[model samples]
Target: MSRIADIAAALAGYDPKALSVDGVQAFLAELVAPAILRERERVPLFEALGRVLAEDVVSPFNVPPHDNSAMDGFAFDGAVLDTPSSGFVSLRVAGTAFAGTARHGALTRGDALKIMTGAVMPAGFDTVVPQEFCTVDGDTVRFPANALRPGDNRRFAGEDLRQGLPALLQGERLTPAGLGLLASLGQAEAPVLRRLRVAYFSTGDEILSLGEPPREGAVYDSNRYTVFGLLTRLGCQVVDLGMVRDDPAALADALTDAAERADAIITSGGVSVGEADHTRAVMKQLGDMAFWRVAMRPGRPMAVGLIPRSSAGDAHEGAAVLFGLPGNPVAVMVTFLAFVRPALLRLMGCNAANAAPPPMLRARSVAPIRKKPGRTEYQRGRVTCLPGALPEVRIAGNQGSGVLSSMVEGNGLVVLHHAQGSVAPGDEVDVMMFDGVV
Candidate 1:
């Protein structure tokens, strides 16, 4: 059987009318595979932000390269203070150790070296008394016997990153800290997978593009822009297909064109049981597709499958995965965040383990929530924290699927689970924040 057939067979038991959120996620995880890039190019460290590492980065040398002082203090032999007779130990300063200077000779007993922070430790000193605890007079320093232990405020060589160790594993995404770490290792360039190319469009006869004159019945297309922003943040090379009318020919042409040029194609609108929608029909002609009624509010109608290349229609020509999102603006964002985002990450060569759903935080509801026990609800909410209290959340005024303003007014989604029913005012709910993607 074909790969599509195998996926279909695996999902044969899924009840389209009442599918669980977990069930949809599990099916997607198994159906999609990482698209690893064979070609890798080096990008400058400054340009490597948000890029995934294509190769393991091994350290060429220890981070510090030498033992050093972690603070501005006096470095001395801890043995001299092991048995101080009067609860204090005094040591004559032999010399000063400054950062960037060469290593100094060993210190004799009852002697110390005035060392600055990050200065290489002298040959025989294993302890440092911070300046705050030391009394310095001319060439001598005094410290309380118990103020410092045998190895206080000293940084050993290779403590952070040892030589020849893997500093970063393959498939790791580079953060600000990661870039700094790479810079410390003297890496000017990073090996990263090429960005994935994603093409997206909106399907609706009543949808209007920007700069077009507004009409009474037509609505401005917002899904395309939202999808664009999301894909751009993920670092994908995005291809905007603009707005396609609800005609079979127009959709088929757009799908074929997008499939030929991009790694994935995303369309918002026309996966539902609407007479004006031709997306479902065109999708079936292009490839094997599954139209699902997921058990989730505002995003029940979804389409997932692969669109074969136009020319050879063979595996070699490659297939572009399709994610047909709901038409409602708020629903578009919710469904994309829940399903399409992770799939796009996997297609970009990110590690499967790192493509899990965004984490949810527990928050107390400030108002009662009316919900059914079957379908999961993603209600837009305003979450706030009080002093010494748990985070409190309340749903934005309108819960309509088409209420885009509600999404704009809220910071997160109150995720009512599939088995959960109505919730009282003080009940706890799981909320997914929009600050960052997992």
Candidate 2:
């Protein structure tokens, strides 16, 4: 049996009418396991940003490498401060220690070294008194009694990272901070997973490309550009196939070409129950494809399967995974976020746990929302922080699938889950922000 058929067989118990958002996600996780577990490539540290690590990176040496002073102050033995005869104590300044200079000799009783920040602390010293806290008199420094105890304002060797310990684990996506950590460890290069290539196109006769004049029943294609931006941000190598007309032969050719070249294929439109949908027919003819009526608003019809490469002599060689999204501009964006984004991350070798849905925050509803219980809904909303209460969210005007401007105007999505009824004013709802305030 084909790979797609095997996956479908494994999910034989899945019911589309009663499908939960999580159920679709779980099935996708299993479907793309084979493509995600591939080989790794070694890339330079500077070029490793947004790439997933293929192996654990262990530190070869301590971060600081030596005990040092954390501030510009006097370092003295704390033993002398154990017994205070008065409300103050005085110590003679023996010498000065600057950063990158050789260590001054060990401190003697009643003697202190004037130390600069990051300078190696003299042996037999356990504390530092900030320069401003001590009153300097000629060659001596006086401190208030009980100003500091042992081990204050001192940084020990390996405090940040110890030698022979894992600095970053495999499957970790390298962020800007993560890059700095690797640089601190003197790593010149990192082993990262190979980038996943995705091929995408738009399918419809009514869709017009740029430079085409507006006609009576035609609209410019926006789904391809939106998908391109989303895929590029996720670090995938995107192959733009432009727009394909609703022709059986053209659809078959595009799918075959994409299957041979890309790791996955994403297409918007021509998969729903529409008369002009030649894409669905070509998909079934080329390989094992299943059209699903997902129980979700904005985006309900989705297709998942594998398209095999046909040999010149009519034999099948290999295949690529397929993700067919809805035609509406807003639906395309919503479904891609809810499903395709995480799937692509997994295909790029990210950890499964990290590829799950973005965290949701609770916010009060400023306006009532009309909703039913059977399907999950995502409404574009503007969320604002109240003076002394939780954030309040109100839906952007026009919740229709074709209204793409609402998504652009809103900063977050108000999520209504399955089995949830109509929302009342002042009710707390779940929100997923587009850009989180850190």
How well is each residue in 254-278 modelled by candidate 2, as lDDT tens digits?
9988887788899999988778898
Model 1 per-residue lDDT tens digits across residues 309-359: 855422224788888899999889998888888877776667766566678
| Residue 355, candidate 2: C-alpha displacement in angstroms | 1.8
For candidate 1, report its TM-score.
0.94
Candidate 1 clashes between residue pairs 3 or more apart in a chain or in different chains: none
Model 2 lDDT, residue 271, Cα: 86
Model 2 clash tally, residue pairs:
0
Superposed Cα RMSD, model 2: 3.2
Q: What is the lDDT of residue 301 in candidate 2?
A: 89
